[model samples]
Structure formats: structure tokens, C-alpha cells
Target: MEITIEDLPGHTKASLSGRFDTTGAIAIELPFNTLANERRALVIDLSNVTFMSSYGIRVLLRGGKIAMSKGAKLVIFCPDTAVSKVLTRAGTSDLIPVYPTLSAATAAVS
Candidate 1:
């Protein structure tokens, strides 16, 4: 699994791929923690992500909480139905905004 971070003007995007859960926490957290240092707004891209668990959803929600605590907007994009289901079931979607497209997320953050 890989989590690649890209810096945007007012936010950051973490491109997530492969299985994202307890097993991939380190990889995911590295980029997320990077975003926490400088940027307040964050957008996690899930276009390439194939698998997710409750722990993966926790990562997203936790990141969201951190971003929001810094007076930021935390948006998640391109989450497939399977991944979305996990967050939905965990009620994480209620806290984090899920965008169907990167354009929408980028627009929101920008």
C-alpha cells in the first residue's frame, strides 16, 4: 500500500492505495502527519484504494478531527462504495465530508 501526499495551495491531498487498515497505519499516518504540520485543510483521495476496514475509517476520521481542530476543512474524495460503506457503517461519514469527485473536494477546500 502507498499513501502519497501532494501539497496544494491551501490544503493537502493524500492519495491512498491498496489495503488501508491496521496493517497500513504507518504508511498512511506518515503522510497524514505531514499534512498536520503545515496545512489545516486536507483532502484524502481514495480513487486508487481498493480495500478498507474500520481501522482505515478511523484513520480518516482521526485525521479529520485533527484538521478540524486546527480550524480546517477535511474532505475525502473518490471513495468507492465498498470503502464508503465501511465509513457509513461506522458513522464516520457524519463527521467527514465525502465528495464524489476531486473537483468537488478541491473546490470546497479552495
Candidate 2:
């Protein structure tokens, strides 16, 4: 997996590609947690992600909770159907809003 973070005016955008499995989750935990701890709105772009595991859901949940507690927003964008199904089945989609487009995701957090 690859994680690329970008700074937006009011928030941070993290673009993720490849599989979001245990290894991938571990790889991004530090950076992702750090960003969440910053207490700023966050946009996670999952358009390029091909797969998502339960571990990935856990990481996202943790980040979302931390961000929410700090009054920061966290939204996901463009997850592939497979990953989207995983999130929805895991009820993660309910906790973190997922948008079909980057514009929509950013708008929601903004």
C-alpha cells in the first residue's frame, strides 16, 4: 500500500493506493494517527485502493474516532466496490461518511 498526504487549506488529504490489509494498515498507522491527532479535518481518498481488510477498518475507525473527539472531520472518497462492500458490511460506512467523488468528500468535511 502507498499513502500520500497533502495539505489542504482547512484540512489534510491522504490518498491511499493498493491493498489496505494488515501490512498496509501497519505501514500507515503512524502517519495516519499523527494526522488524526493534529485535530484538523481529514479527507481519505481511497479511489485507488483495490482491497480492504478488517484491520484496515479498525485503523480507519480509530482515526475517525480520534478526529471526531477533537472536533475534526474525517471522510472517505471513491472506495472501489469491493472495499466499499467491506466497509458497509463492517458498518464502518456508517461511522465515516463515504463519497463517490473527491469534491463531495472535501465539501462534506469543509
Candidate 3:
């Protein structure tokens, strides 16, 4: 996976691309942790993520927990249909609201 993080006022947005499998999940751990520590809210843009595995879901859940513990929120935006299915089936969508648009995702935490 490739991650590009942008810091916005009161929140951060990370744009991710490629397959979000075990390797991809591993690659993002540190950056996610950093963002969780620094921001009041996070928005993960997954529009370019072609696939998502259980490991990927774990990464998101872990990050979300960390953010919550720090009094922050984590949201995901624009995941592909396949990735959305995995998140929904895993029940992660309920835990961390998934938005179909950037505006909606940003608004949720704003």
C-alpha cells in the first residue's frame, strides 16, 4: 500500500492505494499511530484501495481504538465495493462509519 497523509485543521486525511493486505497493513502502522496521536480526527481515503484483507481491517480497528482513546475519531471514505464488502462483513463499518464521499467523512468528525 501507498499512504499519503495531509494535515488539515483539527483533523488529518490519509490517502491510501494498492492492496491493503498484511504487508500493506504493516506499512501503515507507524504513520497511523502518529496521526492518531496528533489529530483530533482522522479520515482514511480508500478510494484507490483495490482490495482489503482481514489484516487490513485489523489495522483500521487498531488505529480507531488508539484514536478513540486519545479522544479522537477515525473515519474511512470512498472504499471500493470489494473493500466495502469486507469491512461490512467484518462489522467494522458499524464501528468506524464509512462515508461514500470526502465531504461526508470530513463532516462526520468536524
Best by TM-score: 2
Question: Where does candidate 1 have its weakest 10-residue lDDT segment?
Answer: 29-38
Error of 2 at 33 (Å): 0.6
Q: Write the per-residue lDDT of candidate 3 for residues 37-80, one digit (tens) a residue.
A: 77888899999999899889988888889989998888999745
Model 1 stretches with alpha carbons more than 4 Å out: none
Model 2 residue runs over 4 Å out of place are none
Ranking by lDDT: 2, 3, 1
Please give, for residues 41-77, the per-residue lDDT of candidate 1 as tens digits.
7788888887787678777777877777788777889
**Rank order (by TM-score, best first):** 2, 3, 1
Q: Candidate 3, clashing residue pairs?
A: none
What are the models' TM-scores?
Answer: 0.87, 0.94, 0.93
Clashing pairs in 1: none
Cα lDDT, model 3, residue 42: 89
| Model 2, span 1-110: residue lDDT tens | 88899997987899999899999999998888888889488999999898899889889999998898898899999645888888888888888999988999999988
Give the clash count for model 1. 0
TM-score of 1: 0.87
Q: Whole-model lDDT for model 1 versus the true structure? A: 0.78
